[model samples]
Target: MTQRADVVVVGGGQSGLAAGYHLRRLGVDFVVLDAQSAPGGAWQHTWDSLRLFSPAAHSSLPGRLMPAQQGETYPDAGHVVDYLSDYEKRYELPVQHGAQAQAVRRDGGRFRVETEAGDWSARAVVSATGTWSRPFLPAVPGQDVFTGRRLHTVAYRRPADFAGQRVVVVGGGNSGAQIAADLALAGDVTVTWATQRPPRFLPDDIDGRTLFDVATARRRALDAGRSDTGGVASLGDIVAVPPVRAARDAGLLHAKPMFTRLTATGVQWADGSRSDADAIIWCTGFRPALAHLAPLGLRGPRGHIPTAGTRAVAEPRLHLLGYGDWTGPASATLIGVGRPARDAARDIAQQLSS
Candidate 1:
């Protein structure tokens, strides 16, 4: 027997939870299917030392503000997990854990969501499956032959495990910078930072809050027919967090250009210079985890489904929430995901009512 709901939100992460919050307010019949055994979404998989760039107040989802311990500025991953767990409990969102959605296909006027647990027929489907499950690694020459340990940021845990080894951290984003700093601080390892381009750093005062504000302003300006000056710092630019700042102070934040190829023992530079390394940590970002939506055949180039304000352009019955800015500006962040989720829920409700 096929279960039915007004909407099926695939992924019970922060994005799906936010959507559930709005849907619950509208009294809509919706179910959030989560892959994990418990709450917290992707936060449970992050490295132990990870911390939000924004303070607790700035990094909150809609409705409830994330509570921080006294004197705690930026909340760690565990804090986020706890907050998410509590938020779901407080709202009593209809989320079914361990129900991993495998595929989604249109069935008559509704959508059929096939999951590990069962099949759900929904009027609309909101894919809040964020990028945590799809860590990306750029292909370089001789990558298959590399003998050393290579890992993406998704699998990274603690720095102690990598102590006393030559480590090369790749990617110019915040993760790379932070992980490099962590490695440098944890042990007497030789840390080599590699980036495709020189890493751009936001000023000491700028954090995720400032970046969101800047993004919002830029979006407004563009919408208002004004030319954006592009002066605001990019969200991808590394922020000088306390640890990153310490790394900079200690002259360990220097970055080298990306290596030309991977050598058996390490990596080779464009100049053919080679250096031995025990491990390579790839902090490259992620692609949207949209495999469940593959049955719909909506994915465009690079696995991204074209969207307009969280609604799929080709498939109006499908709404992709919290994937990234394509769905909504700043939608991938903890605080930023709520807007799109709310909009998605409202749209889904409207569709169902109609």
Candidate 2:
């Protein structure tokens, strides 16, 4: 079946919802397509203990502030999921669940979006699918032959699953630190946290909101031809959330340089020393989910779609939200997505009206 709208959003997560809210307020007709069967987007796939980097209020979409969890300052994955689900219903966004977008292409004057559920032709398209579906694992020698259990952060559910196992956790980002701490606190898993560089923990109070502000300020200064003031990245890599702080204070977390290579039953370090690990967990990051836009041929040599703000440089009718800083100052975050979404909607409205 073919459905038509003024716009079509390719995700139903926080980004997609934000785009929907703005598009609706602008009096644009749109439908959001989600691959997942339910609400919450990737939050539904997050581990049981995963917590937001900020409090609920600081991590909310536009039109509605996320309600606080009574006893927890940093809300858990379930709390985020609940908020997203509620936000969708509260705004009455037109999101079609279980509609996985397969490909998108220019169909004459309109964009045709093909999905598992059906087809949509829209005057404008919003690609809001974030990076969760495309987990990135760096290529390491001998990793292909490692006999032990190998896992990526995407599939990880809980620390209890790794209890009593000798594990090597790789990656220097927030995920690696959090997962390492979770396993250590389980009291049974033997962990060796590995990183490309020494992990730098941000101040206890420096959370997502603060980082977003600093990053934004730095970006604007640079764009205005002023000297780079500095971004949150210059301060640290890790957010030092509650669990990581507790684990660090308790001396349960320590970092080792990443292993040179993986052995059949362990990893070998640069010093030629080896640590026997029963499992290897790659807490590496993710790439932007842009496979659906492949047919558009918009991605450049750097694997990114060139954009003027959120709108594609080549295809002005397409706007990409929530990919990262390049789309907007901090468009990937729930709170930060609001401004970019509004701008994208406004631009679309103007473009269509003209």
TM per prediction: 0.97, 0.98
Q: Over the stretch 20-50, how does candidate 2's per-residue lDDT look in tens digits? A: 9998999998999999999999999988789
lDDT of 1 by residue, 8-40 (tens): 999999999999999999999989999999999
Candidate 1 Cα errors over 4 Å, as ranges: 229-236
Clashes in each model (backbone N, CA, C under 3 Å)? 0, 0
Clashes of 2: 0
Best by TM-score: 2
C-alpha lDDT score of every prediction, in listed order: 0.89, 0.92
lDDT of the structure predicted as candidate 1: 0.89
